[model samples]
Target: MHVLFLAPEVWPFKRVGGLAEVAYDLPRALAALGHKVGVVTPKPRLSQEMEQGLERLDTVLEVPVSWKRHLAEVYRHQEPSGVEVYLIGHEHLFDREGLYGNAYGDYEDNAERFIFYSRACLELARTMDWRVDVFHANDWTTGLVPVYLRTLYAGDPCLKDAASLMTVHNLGNQGQFWHYDMPLTGLGWEYFVPEALEFYGQINFLKGGLVFADMISTVSHTYAQEILTPELGRGMEGVLMARRDRLAAVVNGIDYQVWNPADDYRLAANYDRHDPSPKARCRQELMGHYGLEDGGGRPLVAVVGRLEDRKGLDLITAGMERFFEVGLNLVVMGYGEDHYHVALGELAARHPGRLGLTIGFDIDLAHRIMAGVDMLLVPSRYEPCGIHQMQALRYGVVPVVRDTGGLADTVVDQRPGVEGTGFKFEPFTMEAMLQTLDRAKQAYDRPQEWRGLMQRAMAQDFSWQAVAPRYEEIYRKALELAGQRQRA
Candidate 1:
């Protein structure tokens, strides 16, 4: 089977979140499984320096977006794993410092920019000799791929019969635009109804994909079910419930090659599940690097990723005093809302040595933290499928995640005869999180029990090798659905 992935970002070229990592690793995993795979993404300006081996293709695609025609330059790169990556370059649209926008906010033209890229994806596919059995669209940026496939290219030989799978990484970020911008979609105003692209008079790109795609999927089974409720749906629950039959979920996987502690060059000391004694050196280095005073034998807990409200930063802030009292040292990395920056900065200042904070993301620092931290905190209010928890597991850093979404699916709370990998709290409140942390600290004090938990986490597998087959199954089901739709 031949699968084509459409995403706004692909790792090592351009990345903003977990979607990029999924785009990077999943294709290669599928290719290794003996299926032909390809990826289509916009060429961000920064990728030029990173992708030195990129080949400029002779084919120039004239992509139509509403009333305008934009020419897209194609660049090709062949991965060692036999996956083809096609980057569509448009200087005026994509040659920006950031893939979506700068620090100020999201690009105002995000809707128009992605509409052109979605059209270009189909146009580029038309030029290729490869036949795509499934066009996998990721997130809101490429949501229009399925919409266009069913509308504009309905009669086209190459794409008409091809099924589409729209993967919603985060329903909260549905590409919503002003109603006036509906013209940019090149679809009839009739499609602007609530049954299709419309969301409270706004042109919702993700809604269109959900309505038109052969099948829809989210990152984890729990999240798939969560999005159908008013609490987590972000106003798309009714539409999702209307088409729940077509919805499916698979947990996101980590690329062990990139996450394995044994071979990670970024760590100060490398160790696997067999001999994790070297982790002590990594812990010492982490403490020294962050200027954190040694806590005698206190657990070094780290919170990694964006400091946003949904990430439960509020809970962490509320529980800071309790955390310090329980003999736990905390370090936080990743940047987000200004309020969180100020709040966390003030907290870190008020409690010097015990609390350490880094305002931005650093890949090397992330790796070192994974190896060094005794426990990783991922107290998200609602996580689609958290990659950090998976990475923490791979490094034998026990994850203390909220029992919601993918976190619930991945981490098993320790109980008698359970052999769990991590700790889980049910409610999204500071008290619940604190209680879980206290329990984790108790377990930590027991050296033999802690070692057993760490070894169990490392032994568990969440590799793409185990995940890609599930995608292949989804693709086949999508193909069957598309065939039935065509016949009808």
Candidate 2:
């Protein structure tokens, strides 16, 4: 199959979230599975590794921006597993130091920027005569791909037979903008309907993809079902329900080659599924590095990813004094709201021994934090499907995740013989999380019981080798749908 992935970011090049990581790793695995997979993403400000990695491919294609056209270069990189990556290189649109923006706010012209990129990718693919079998677009940034292919590019020779699959990593960011902006970016006003792009009287880029794409998928099966609800649904329930048969819930996978604790380059000491003692050594190293005590007594709970309200970072902040009261230490690596940043800063200052907070992601430190921490926290309000819990589990860091979305699907609560993988709570409330943590705290006191579950979690597999076939089936299903449409 000839697969073309469209996204705003890709790992090792531009990573602001899990979508980039998926974009980077999944194509490699898909290529290994005998598919011709390639990705088209905005060229991030290049690093030495990035510059060395990508070979210049097709160059200087003009893509329409609001009203005028801008030039972009396409560079290709073949991954170790032989997946070709096409980077859309244009400085004016993507030359910024940050992926999205700095601390103040995202670029005001984000809607126009991503929409232009989406159209550019399709236009480039058409010009290259790449009749994509599956144009799998990730998140809202590239949501316009399916809409453009199905509508404006409907009968174009290169895109006439192409099918699309849009995976909702998280529904919260629906990319809502002023409905009037549609015309400015060349999107038809017909797309701004309640059933299509419009959500709560605004243009919703994410819903446009969900409506027009041949098929839709969320990160996990649980998330797939969860999105069809009123509470969890971000006003897309009706649209999601309309496409019930077209929706799938395949859990996200981790790049074990990079994340494996046993062979991790970031860890202080390598450890396996059997012996987890190195976890303690790694923990001490992490504590020492963060200027915390190296004492091996307090249970270290580390949380990575965005420290936003949606990620349940609020529960952590609300329950900070309680975490220390429960005799636990905290470490965080993420960036978000000013209030969150200031609050976390204060927590780190007030409670030196119990907390360590870094404002943004540190790749090496993230791996070390995963390997070192006794438990990893992902109390997400709504995680479509998280890859961190899987990575933390593989690293022998028992996850204490809120019972929502993929967390509910992946991390099994501690049982008797089943001694499950990690811990789970309900309601997405601090009280609920604290109650579960209390139980986890009790379990932690029983080192033998805790170790059994942590090992069990590490033993579980969340590999792409297991998930790529699911995506393959979905891709085929999209082709089937396209065939039906053609026959009609």
Candidate 3:
């Protein structure tokens, strides 16, 4: 089977969040399973630097946009396992410093930019004459790709039979815009109804994909169920409910080659499941880096990623007093919300060596922190899927995550007789998160139980090896659904 993955950003060249991580890992996993897989994404400004060992295939074609005719170049890279990647380079949409917009806001023309990319993807597949069995679309950026397959190319022999699977990374980012832009997508006002692109009288790209695509997926099984509710759907539960039969849940996986503890160059000492000596060295390095006391008395807990309301960071912020009172050392990283940033800095200043804080994105520090810390904190209000927790688990660091989305699906609660992987909290409140943290702190007292939990988390395989076959099944299901539609 041949599959085309459509996204706004790809890994290494452009990474905004977990979507890029999934885009990077899943296709290669599928290719390893003996499927012909290809990807089309807006070439990032850093693409040239990241294109080492990749060959420029050729100038594909002139792709049309509402603004201008963009010349798209196709580049290919074969992984060690024989998976292929094709990058679509267009200067106008992608020649920017960042994958997402700058600190101010999102790109003003994101809708138009992604619409152009989706159209170019279809054109490339048609010109190459590839019998694309499945077109796997990610997030809201490439949402219109499925719409094009089902509407514009519905009757064309070259495209009519191609199936599609659309994954919604987050429900909030629905690419909502004015209804007038429907014509620009080559679809008419007819699609701007309650059942199609419409969401409360506005146009929604993700909604269109959910309504028109052969099958729909969210990041995790729990998330698949979450989005069908009024509280979590972000105003699209009605449409999702109508198409629940075609909806399924397959959790995301990590690239083990990069995330494996034994081979990771980011750590001070590399250790695997067998030998745990290197982990102590890494922990010491982490403590030294953060100015925390390198001792076994107090466990060091690390919190990473954006400091926003949605991350439920307020829970942590509100519970700082308890941490200091309980003699727990905390390390905080990543950036968001000016007020939260200021408050955290003040907490560190007041607590002296007990608290460590870094205010922005640093890839190297992230890996080191994960490896060094005894526990990771991820208290999200509603996480579709989080990659950092998986990274922490791989490093033998138990994660204390809110029991929602992928966290619920992956983390097994380490209570008495449970034999779980990590600590899980419910209610999405400060008290609940604090209770879970207290449990993690309690587990730190018993070294054998802590080691057993760490070993369990490390032993559990979250790699794409176990997940790709499920995706293959999804593709086959999409093809079957498309065939049924044709017969009907």
Predicted model with the maximum lDDT = 1
Q: Model 1: per-residue lDDT, tens digit, 1-488?
A: 98999999998787677888999999999999999889999988864466678989999999987789998899998999999999999999999988878889889999899999999999988987557899999988888889998898998988889999999999989989999998998899988998889988899999889999999999999999999999999998998998899899999999999999999999899999999889999999999988888768899999999889889999998889889998899999988788989988998999888888999888889999999999999999899999999999999999999999999999999978898999999988888898899999999999999999999999989999999999989999999999998999
TM-score of each: 0.97, 0.96, 0.95
Off-target runs (Cα >4 Å) in candidate 2 are 294-296, 416-418
Q: For model 2, how does the per-residue alpha-carbon lDDT over 1-488 read when each residue is reduced to its tens digit?
A: 99998888888788888988899888888998999988998888887876987788745787876677877888888777777778888788788977667767778778877887898889778778887899999888888888888788888988889999999998888887887687756766776778778888888889889999999998988888888999888788989999999999899999989989888887889999889887878987998888876455778888899889888978889899999887788899998778999999998999887798899888988898998888888898888888889999998888899888899999999856666899888887888888878788788889898888888988898998898999999999999998898789
Point out where model 1 deviates above 4 Å: none
Is candidate 2 or 3 superior in lDDT? 2
Q: Lowest summed lDDT over 10 consecutive residues: which window, candidate 3?
A: 58-67
Expressed as tens digits, the lDDT of each residue in 143-235 for candidate 3 is: 888888988878877788999998899997888877777666877778888878888878888888888899998789999999999999988
The 10-residue segment with the lowest total lDDT in model 1: 44-53
Every candidate's lDDT: 0.91, 0.86, 0.85
Q: List the residue pairs that clash in candidate 3.
A: none
Ranking by TM-score: 1, 2, 3
Candidate 1 — number of clashing residue pairs?
0
